[model samples]
Target: MSAAPFTVLIPARLASTRLPGKPLADIAGLPMVVRVARQAAQSAATQVVVAADDARIVQACAAHGVTALLTRTDHASGSDRLAQACDLLALPDEAIVVNVQGDEPLVAPALIDAVAALLRARPEASMGTAAHAIDSWQDFISPHVVKVVLDAQGLAHYFSRAPIPHARDQAEGQAWWQQAPLQRLAPLRHIGLYSYRAGFLRRFPQLAAAPTEQLEQLEQLRALWHGHAIAVHVTQQAPAAGVDTPQDLERVRALLGHG
Candidate 1:
C-alpha cells in the first residue's frame, strides 16, 4: 500500500490566560498562529489546517490563505478541538492527523516529519510523539518540563512532572555511580507535538478521562490508561519554545532577530 496522506491541524484559541488573544499576537510582522501553520505546511504532510474557536483566528488564517476550520470553544484541550476539525473536514479513518500546537511559532519542520513518519511506520501505534534527552538537572527536575519514560521498543511507559529512573546511586555517592553513564541515563523531555490516526483521533474525546491524567494535567496519560501504545520518536535537537507569556514571545523574537 502507498503512504497515507498526513494533515497538520493547529488548534488555536484566542482566550489565553497568560497572553490573551495569543494567536493574533504579532511575531516578526505575522501573527503567531499564521507562522505556526506556515511552518507545519513545510512538513511532508499533504495539507495544513488551523482549527480555531474564534472568528478572529479564522480571519488571521484566511489572511494568510491557509485552510481554517471553526471549532467549538467548549473543548477543553487542543486534541479535542483537532478532532472536531477532522470531523468538519470529513477525514477518513486511515488518514494521518498531526496536532501542531499553535503557540509554537518556531516549530521545526523536521520534528513534524519525525512524529508523522513514526506513526506511518507503526501501524499498531494509536498515537506518536517526540522526546529529547534531558541534559541538565534543572530541566530534569523542573515540573514545567514534562519527562517521559519509554519502554524497550521506544513506546512511552510513563510521563511525569518528576524525573524517572531516579539516580539512587548518585544520591548515595556510590563509586560505581561516578563511573556510570549519567548523561545517557537522564530522563527524556516529552515534546508537545503529536500525530494520530484519524480514527483514533475521533475516539479520543469519548475515552473517559484517567484519574492520573486529571492529577497530572497531561492528556496523553489517558491513552496509557486505556492500554494504547504511544510510540516515541527520539530526536537529537530540542523543540522550539511555545510562546505562553510576554517573556517567551520576547525570546522567540530575539531568536528570530526581529526589530
Candidate 2:
C-alpha cells in the first residue's frame, strides 16, 4: 500500500475525573498537552495540532510553540473533538487523522505512524487502532483496561471491559494466565490511539451510540454497530501507559524529572 499524508490531533480536556486540569498539569516544566504535542511532532504527521477544549490549554500550547485550536467544551469524546478540528482545518475526505490523547506524553512516534499506515493499507476499514497482548493477569482482569478480540483478518470482533476469550478449562485457579497464552485469537489490551479517515470521522458522531457502546463505555462499538470495520494493528511492543490519575501524574513527573 502507498503511504498517505496524515495529521495528528491531540484532544485535551481540562476536567479529568482523576486529575482535574490535566491538560495544563505540568510535566517537566511544560504543560501535559504540550508534552504530548511535542511527542506527536516527532511522528511522520504532516501537522500536529492540539484540539483543546479550554483556552488555558491553547495558551499553554502557544507558549510551547505547539499549534492548538480551541474547540467546543461539550464534545462527548476525543473523536468528536477531532471531527471539529478536521472541519476547522478543512481537511480533505481522504486525509488521515490520528487522535492522540493529551495524557500520552510517552507515546511512541512509530505507533502513531503504524496506525495511520494500517488505515491506508485497508481501504475497506473506516478507522484503525493498535493493541498488544495482555501479559499480566491484573491487566487482563482490570475493568479499566479495555480488551479487544480480533477476527482472522485483524478486524476487531468486539471490545469489552470484561475478561474475554475465557479459558473455561483453566477457570479454577492461577493456571488460566499460563494456559491462555498470546495466540492469534488471544485477548489484547486495546491501546486508545486511533487513526480515522477525515470523511469517516466527520460522520462518526452521526452513528447513534450502540447499546454495547453505552454499556462498555467504548465508542468504537458505535462504528461496529454501523457496520464499519476498524482495523486492529497488533504490535508486540507495549506502549507506556497514559496518565489518568494523581499517582499517574506523579509517576510521569518522576520519569521526566520535575521542572
Candidate 3:
C-alpha cells in the first residue's frame, strides 16, 4: 500500500483545571497552541490544524497563520476533538491524523513523523504512538509518568501509571527499586503523541471504557481493550514534556528565554 496522507491535529481546551486557558497561554509572546501548530508544520504532515474549544484559541492561531477549528467543548478527550476535526476537514477514513497535544509547544517534528510512519508501516495497527527508554529511577516509579510495554512486534501490550514489567528481583521489600542509578532499563516511557487512521479515530469515542482505563485514567487502554493494535515507535530520545501546571508553564517560558 502507498503511504497515506497525514494531518496533524492539536487539541486545545481552554478550561484546564491545572492551568485555565492553557491553549492560549503565552510562551515567548506566542500562544502555546500556535507554538505547537508551528512545530507540527515542520513535520511530514500535509497540514497542521488546531482543534480548539474556544474562540480565543482560534484567534490566537489565526494571528500566527495556523489553522484552528472550533470544536465541541463537551468532548471528553483530545481524540474526540480530533474526530470532529476530521469531520470538519472532510478527511477520508484512510487519512492519517496525528494527535499532537496543544500544550506540547516543544514537540519534535521527527517524533510526529515517527508515529505517523509507524502507523503507515503497520497496516494491522489502528493507532501508533512513541516511547523511549527510562533513564531516571524517579520517572520509572512516578505515577505521573505513564509506562508502556511493547510486544515483540513493537505493538503496545499495556500502558499504566504504575511501573510495568515490574523488576521483581529489584524489589525493595514492597517497593520496586533500580539498584544501579546509571543503568537505563528496558521499560519504556510512553509519549502522549498519537497517530490514528481516521475511521478508528472517529470511532474512538464510542469504544466502551474498560476497567483498566477507569483505574489508570488512561483513555488509550480503551483501544487495547477493544482489541485494536497500537504500534509503538521506540525513539532514541525522549520528547520534551508538555505544560500541564503553573510550574510547567514557567519552565517552558524559561526554556524559551522568557522567564
> Best TM-score goes to which candidate?
2
Candidate 3, residues 1-259: lDDT per residue as tens digits? 5455699999999998999988888899998888899889999889999998989889888989999999998998888899999999999999989999988999999999889988779999999999988867678789999999988888999999998768766644333323465244467899999999899999999888999999999999999999999999989987898899999999999999884
lDDT against the true structure, each candidate: 0.88, 0.90, 0.89
lDDT of 2 at 242: 93
Estimate, for each residue in 8-104, the C-alpha lDDT of model 2 and write its tens digit: 9998999988889999998889898988999999989999999998898898899889999999999988888999999999999889999999999
lDDT of 1 by residue, 160-213 (tens): 997676776465323222245765555799999999999999999999999999
Worst 10 residues of 1 by lDDT: 171-180
Kindly report which residue stretches of model 3 are placed more than 4 angstroms away from their true locations once superposed: 1-4, 173-185
Off by over 4 Å in 2: 173-177, 180-182
Higher-scoring candidate on TM-score, 1 or 2? 2
In model 2, where is the ten-residue run with the lowest total lDDT?
Answer: 173-182
Error of 1 at 123 (Å): 1.6
- Comparing 2 and 3 on TM-score, the stronger one: 2
The clash numbers for all candidates, in the given order, read: 0, 0, 0
